[model samples]
Target chain A: MAIFSLWVINKAGGLVYQRNFADGLAQLTSNEHLVLAGTLHGIHAITSRLSPIGASSGAQVIEGESFKMTIFLTATGTKFVLFTSLHETTTDSVLQRVYEAYADAVMKNPFHTPEMPIRSEGFDSRITALIGTGQS
Target chain B: MTIYSLYIFDRHCTCVYYQDWHRTKRPKPAVEGGILPAVSHAITPQPLPADSNAGSTFTSPRNTLTSTSGVVIAVNEPISPGPGLYQTPPSHQQTQANPPPSTSGLAFDEEAKLVYGVILSLRNMIKRISGRDEQFTNYRTSTYKLHLYETLSGYKFVMLSDPNTDSLRFVLRQIYNGPFLDFVVRNPLVIMDSKERGIDNEYFRANTDRLVKGLSVFP
Candidate 1:
């Protein structure tokens, strides 16, 4: 599982965080990022409301032939996204581990604000360590 | 016959007048021309019925003067300033826009400070409602670089970054307009007014664009 980027959107659809990993995406302006955050937040909210209870939240964990966008929940009701793109691999364990890492590194960080951008150095170091160790 | 009337003019310049005509007559005819006394007296100031005051209290603070035909004037005198519950800081050209050497020389450090200040301010705003501080520890080490620029109209924009994250720098601009500007500036409780203290808006707006462009993800 390779996490390509992350984004945080407030309840009001404002983008609080946006990041890209593994590098294939085009660059976007800060304003564009904000707009994307807002739009994604809106879509997530609508998806949640339309979800059938006792089922997973409408956030999709798609494992296409080439890429995936996994949306999961943070403790403060914000979303954590980890995107991965690969030609061939089993993504189940990668996605789950990524979620766990996020819970530990980002959500549990006392310095992290809900619905705000993730900025903790510890979170970054831990993720790099995890991905680095696995790569070797 | 003479009549006094209340007339309403329409948008198309048509006038609709409501009138009660009167004729001077013998005292015996007083009962027959009963409308004059009642109408004239009603036209003069009299205590209105209790229900009249119930609807609304929007008083027009202007005196209406009737001049020649098709002419009307509403003169609204300027209101005197209220007592000094709040004092306004004198207006001046902002120095932060062109900050002195002490400020501009440390532009890099200033950008970092802006990020920290903004984050702390945001956290405080949220904490006012959330009442929790658990997230503070994780957010502390995040590093940011900022750049600022001023538009020709004197508005400022700021670009902000957190280097460890893959996200690009974000930009913020002043979206507030007139009355809201007054609310923040004229408010006595605001310790740093935009015009006087020059810290809040000038710093943030001026460097937004530069900050956004300067963002670089660190290894």
Candidate 2:
């Protein structure tokens, strides 16, 4: 039931926003973060391309020792990645809430410059609150 | 439903446009002068490592070579000279012109700079963290909300409203897709990089004003 972090990646494979909630993960340098995002994007693309049935959407989950990652891609190509405990099964609802928050706070904001990193306090607070409530 | 102001900054971190409305107290005149410089300083991009692969993907084709170097020289002078449209009077001048009213205005300027700096740093940090291109939408404080809408070419539209104000990102996008693209970005008469520091087209202003005012919650 513990959520570690959330990340939003744009169509071009650039990370737009990321927030950490639980604190056990090792910290990464900025360049490492970029590399990680690019790698994930590449892997996602490759996974879709190599799908046995044909080019499907993308990878949905990556289970690790410490946490499990769930990825959801929007029709518009935006990707939402959530890292949570292995026991958490409600990742879909979390992603849905995150998408709604993105649309309401980020998409609806007039000052959000396109293709830049997200810095919306409203979005941050909303997501944090969501995770907090979910954990409790 | 008080809308304090709006500011538009280019990717280069230049405060190209600003306007304030329905505020009882305004920042001091000196405070206004520091905004652009502070924003520019706050937005100064960190030099990327030579081996950085992220740099290649992060760079946009629309950004000119000079902009990448981060030393922006105004290529064209702002077309309009009318101070009426550009200048905002100092709030303290209405009360006392002598010893400079208390530090509230200066404090406000610092707060504004802090907010802008937070936005810029958060943007950069997100890029590093996510390893993908992303855009910020809006931020809300206890007392105020800051909404941002950015174009692909890196033009930023910003608005500050009361905390309870509904979404204004659509309005910003409309302004961008409509009057901004049609009149300023597309129109040859308007120079985005000029010292004039605003979209001087009357048609753009008029239409944008109409759009902003048309918002249901706007005071």
**Clash number for each model:** 26, 25
On TM-score, the leading prediction is 2
DockQ of every predicted complex = 0.02, 0.03
Q: How much is B50 displaced in model 1, in angstroms? A: 48
- For candidate 2, what is the DockQ-based docking class? incorrect
Q: Which stretches of candidate 1 lie over 4 Å from their true place?
A: A1-3, A8-14, A48-56, A62-66, A86-92, A132-136, B1-219
lDDT of 2 at B117: 48
What does TM-score give for chain A of every model? 0.65, 0.92
Local distance difference test scores for all models: 0.34, 0.58
Q: How far is candidate 2 from the true structure (C-alpha RMSD, Å)?
A: 19.8
lDDT of 1 by residue, A51-118 (tens): 11111243344222234445555455555555555432534455456567667887798888765667
User: What TM-score do all the candidates reach, one by one?
Assistant: 0.32, 0.45
lDDT of 2 by residue, B1-219 (tens): 867666677776656555566644443332224344322222222234312322111211111212222222342322221222233234422222122212222223333443454456545544444344644454443445567777888777878676567667787899889878888888897777664444545677677778778877776
lDDT of 2 by residue, A41-63 (tens): 65554333211111234456644
Least well predicted 10-residue stretch by lDDT in candidate 2 chain B: B56-65
